[model samples]
Target: MSDAQRICLGAIAGAFGVKGELRLKSFTSEPEDIAAYGPLESEDGALSFEITLTGQSGKGALIARLSGVNTKEQADALRGVRLYADRGRLPALPDDEFYHADLIGLEVFDTGGAPLGRVKAVLNHGAGDLLEIHAPGMTASVLMPFTREAVPTVDLTSGRIVADPPEGLF
Candidate 1:
């Protein structure tokens, strides 16, 4: 299936125990709700798994059993596999909220209407999200804080973002 047809919902952290249970890192606000998205597909959509939440690990990660996985080796093999749900199953966001998937390809512009570039990715290294812009002439991508002060406007319909970067950031 096409990536545009699905939205990432969670990931397999690795095997959680000697049994087939796997550790899950949920991308949802309500971590447990990851199971509500129905069957999840692998990043490439080459495989699908139906998850049944068993409980939580002592470290707070979610414990789950995936359909057809019955051994530690089977669960361990799924480590680092990203899970995606059909976009149709997701709820619409409020005006101020956006899915990182929707922002990936939007063009970015400065206050003066000059083009910065398109958003290559939205990264969150534990300190809020950053907009990674792949500018036309730059040797490296620029990372801009995705804060209200830095990114004042995001027009999803127009597929454009207006950024008022911190001084000298651009």
Candidate 2:
């Protein structure tokens, strides 16, 4: 799918209860707002579900009911599934901010125009975002800090990022 089509909004944690309730982890700044965009679909768009806010669970989680899910087994089958909303429904981002979807697959380069790699994934472990880049001739991808100092420039329009990696990091 094109980058302009799908924007990830949330993820399914697992089944909350026997009645097909789901433990949802919303990625929106205002978590509850995820339901405003409309029905969410899986990455492949093969599965679609209308989400309803049931209540708030512990630790920034929401209890939700999927339109067609009526059994715990059905909900369990969806654990770890990411939810995407139509990109048109999402708001525009500020200049310095970027969606994880937009960052993935962008070519990364050093300040001197040396090819580093393409961003394979964007990861956040409750600290800050990391750009996982898989460079040529490397066995594994390297995690580069997304900070301004480390990554001097990000030209989304051109699908390129200029990174100033630390000593011996590349």
Top candidate by TM-score: 1
Per-residue lDDT tens digits for candidate 1, residues 1-170, read 67777888889999988899999988876889999988999988788999999999887789999998899999999999999999899988899888889899999999899999999998877788999999999989999999999999999889999999899877
In candidate 2 the C-alpha lDDT for residue 128 amounts to 84
Per-residue CA lDDT of model 2 for 1-170, tens digit only, reads 76568999999999998999999998887889988988999988999999999998876689999899999999999999999988888999998988888999999999999999999998877788899999999999999889999998989999999999988888
Error of 2 at 122 (Å): 0.5
* Cα-based TM-score, every candidate: 0.92, 0.91
| lDDT score for candidate 1 against the true structure | 0.91
